[model samples]
Target: MNWIAALPMYNVTPELAAHWRALLAHVGARLEPWLAARGDSLALIEPDEQLERFWLRDDLLLSQTCGYPLVHALSERVRVIATPAFDIDGCAHGNYRSVLVTGAHVDATTLAQCQGLRAAFNDDDSNSGMNLFRAAVAPLALGKPFFSAVLRTGGHLQSLRALAIDRSADVAAIDCVTLAFVRDRLPELADGIREIGVTQSAPGLPFIASKAVPAEVPALLADALDDAVRADPALARRLKLTGFVRRPASDYASILDIERGAIEQGYPVLA
Candidate 1:
């Protein structure tokens, strides 16, 4: 059967997208001999489907997805492969945080001070943009809406733009990895946006394989990714990828816990 793969989570810019493509090429190269040995052949293709739909495809040999969606929407549909460990601030041992950003001119120094302002989030299903942001603001909400309005920008870059350029929103929670990419590749977009705070850390996005793939596929993919990174220290550093960590599905439950904590605080939603 033909197989497909994508690493869609952190492609924040064209340059960054190119970098991910290069990394994928290296990983695929490392996996070729091993997969051929198993009577399996792999193919790399740019995915055209919406991310969630793409993840659920039967031929989705490999991909990476957010933890919130992993627990809520994709738990049983996909098999966990491994989480990439990044040697970047706000991340450790495959865990990452959301950086709460605001326009540099905004005077609000804390969440409480930002109450009644409009907020932007990538999507309701995003762990970094929504779940973690909600969890951070829940205690300060006192069971009421914290932001006067909430805007779903559909992506972390859009959320950052909402804060930095459009000025339609006062603040946003952006994935730290996305922020890192913007700051490194497209520094201008990050120029006017300043990180005011960060949310509690959770496991980073997990690489996954189609449920139909044999259990050994995930292990093999993980080994190939490690080998690829080890072979090119420069590529690994450029991507901020330190290593890969094989984790069980249970490890992502912490993302759900962060949401539940907010719900229990009576601020079930970001609004």
Candidate 2:
């Protein structure tokens, strides 16, 4: 009965927190016998902390970008229970093209004029912040440097704020999912920023479990997720989680392929 849940850092809010509690309660109620036998309790791990630890534990690990490094990181420790390629549209921060300017320093049209301008990325491990952003610029960076400089800001919100306040970056890719979340909850920032371009669609988050968990764990996790998505209409609408779609390991290989092609073509700024 030692059940654990982890969700993305960006999507955590009071309502979402309540939603998760309810979902976990449903799961716990359904697995009460197992819980009694195991003499354990259910726990919820916040996305920003303990995600790596949860992946290592014989419990469920949930988050976005369940790609190469994460899957490989957990392969020996856990088994991927159910992965939805296009699960929840957690935030509008994925592929929305935007040159977050410093109080009218540059507009979208002006930013586009500066083709080889510097940009800031959230992280190297991020698919939407780094990988998808690289792919968006790959075709345009023929022989010239697409980005004069690239800074790793560690998080999407930091990347956005860096462009607006720091003046160190010319532009930054903002994910639509994060945008949506902020627009609905934190409108001040949303009102100040504007989108200049858009990248291709990126995949959604995945749900996982430990390899040593009961064989029925995967099925139970998937069923619970499906029920949660169906039962929580308000939450679903708030997050725009259309539904869960199953995916395999090969689905994320394209990200690496994009990385390889960019490196081979000498667009190593993205790498």
Candidate 3:
């Protein structure tokens, strides 16, 4: 059977997808002889059904900003190959921390002054939306309640849009990477939104494969990815990828640890 790779749709567009396909094709072609030597062929699938196949076929998956839930869901079946936690940089907190805005036309000072405001969460299972967000606000809510209301918006882009369009939420926490993606792909929406503050940095997503696959698969994939990074400047620039760095399971354990700490501390921000 041909082994497949799945790409997430969150930060990807059709044009960008085409670019990725071409780049992957180059990498795949270079790796084909080796794969064929092992009686396997490589294929890249579309974001929709292909994603399902990845989950089912025990192939590899690549995603950004999809750590928490994906890991939770697939932990028993897969192992993380590599991640970019060390290289991925977030926006400076001095300028772009998450804010609590109001439809009543509240300024930063006024919003900050408000004792209790509504908050919107993209998903309870997101690292950026939950883990980093909790770490950012936990200090401030040391002895007081932070939000009067909290609503789940399903995804980051939807949460951002909900904060602007619904008039129900006073604030929403967004990831810097997602913010940049929106700025590049959906400029109009990005123009209206403002970042109030930034959260602490956490690791980004990992390229994961089924635990059943031979260990050599991950080693080979990692090598091909490193070569792709070294040879293709356009690919590196487009993905903001510095390079693939090997990560052990312990690196991701901190994410689960943060979530557990927040829950134990009775912080509703992550719940």
TM-scores of the models, in the order given:
0.96, 0.78, 0.80
Give the Cα lDDT of each candidate. Answer: 0.87, 0.58, 0.60
Provide the RMSD of all predictions against the true structure, rounded to 1 decimal: 1.3, 4.1, 4.2
Best by lDDT: 1
- Ordered by TM-score, highest first, the candidates read 1, 3, 2
TM-score winner, 2 or 3:
3
- Per-residue accuracy of model 2 over 1-271 as CA lDDT, tens digit each: 4567655544535776665556555555656666677786667666555456656665553333344345345544555554432232432322123223322345545334547666778876666677667766766676467666888998777776666566677667666556666567665555545566666654444555666677776666667667776777676665566556655545555656766776676676563
User: What shift in Å separates residue 223 of candidate 2 from its native position after superposition?
Assistant: 0.3
TM-score of 1: 0.96
Rank ordering of all candidates by lDDT, starting from the highest? 1, 3, 2
> What is the lDDT, from 0 to 100, of the residue 44 in candidate 3?
81
Write down the lDDT that model 3 would get.
0.60
**Pairs with backbone N, CA or C atoms under 3 Å apart (clashes), candidate 3:** 96-197, 97-196, 97-197, 97-198, 98-197
Error of 1 at 82 (Å): 0.9
Quality of model 2 by C-alpha lDDT: 0.58
How many steric overlaps are in each model, in order? 0, 16, 5
Off by over 4 Å in 1: 37-40
